[model samples]
Target: MIRPQWEWALDDVEGRRLSTPVTPVFTAQYDAEQWLGEHWRELAAAGAAQASLLHDGKQAAPGVELRFP
Candidate 1:
């Protein structure tokens, strides 16, 4: 059985996909979420406006806004 690849699809302010310097892939959903939680601030600074969880290239959850105060 092929394991599901969990990742985050980042988008910019204009809704265009972002090709960030770090493309992290996880083996589980929880890991993906944890990583995003820790790095969202950096992503926001890098011009990511939002992020969506993806499982095997399909959207797994609604987008999370990457707002920096």
Candidate 2:
């Protein structure tokens, strides 16, 4: 059976809370990172200075988990 999968969230640098967006649940880390790599600039423009790939209350993406100021 497939696992519950993973999830990704964007956070405001100064706010440090989940972005107002409906964070998506990712099935794999690669997909999450790929999205962040592409959309991070947009998020940053919208007041989100950090993107997080999380699951089970911990970081799901290796090397880069949370990006904050």
Largest lDDT belongs to which candidate? 1
Top candidate when judged by TM-score against the true structure: 1
lDDT tens readout by residue for model 1, 1-69 = 899899999999999998874559999999999999999999998999999999999999999999977
Residue 62: error of model 2 in Å?
A: 7.4
Please, what is the whole-model Cα lDDT of each candidate in the order they appear?
Answer: 0.91, 0.63
Instruction: Give me the displacement of residue 7 in model 1, in angstroms.
Output: 0.3
Clashing pairs in 2: none
Q: How far is candidate 1 from the true structure (C-alpha RMSD, Å)?
A: 1.0
> Alpha carbon lDDT of residue 32, candidate 2?
67
TM-score of 2: 0.66
For model 2, what is the alpha-carbon lDDT of residue 26?
A: 75
Q: Where's the lowest-lDDT run of ten residues in candidate 1?
A: 16-25
The per-prediction tally of clashing pairs is: 0, 0
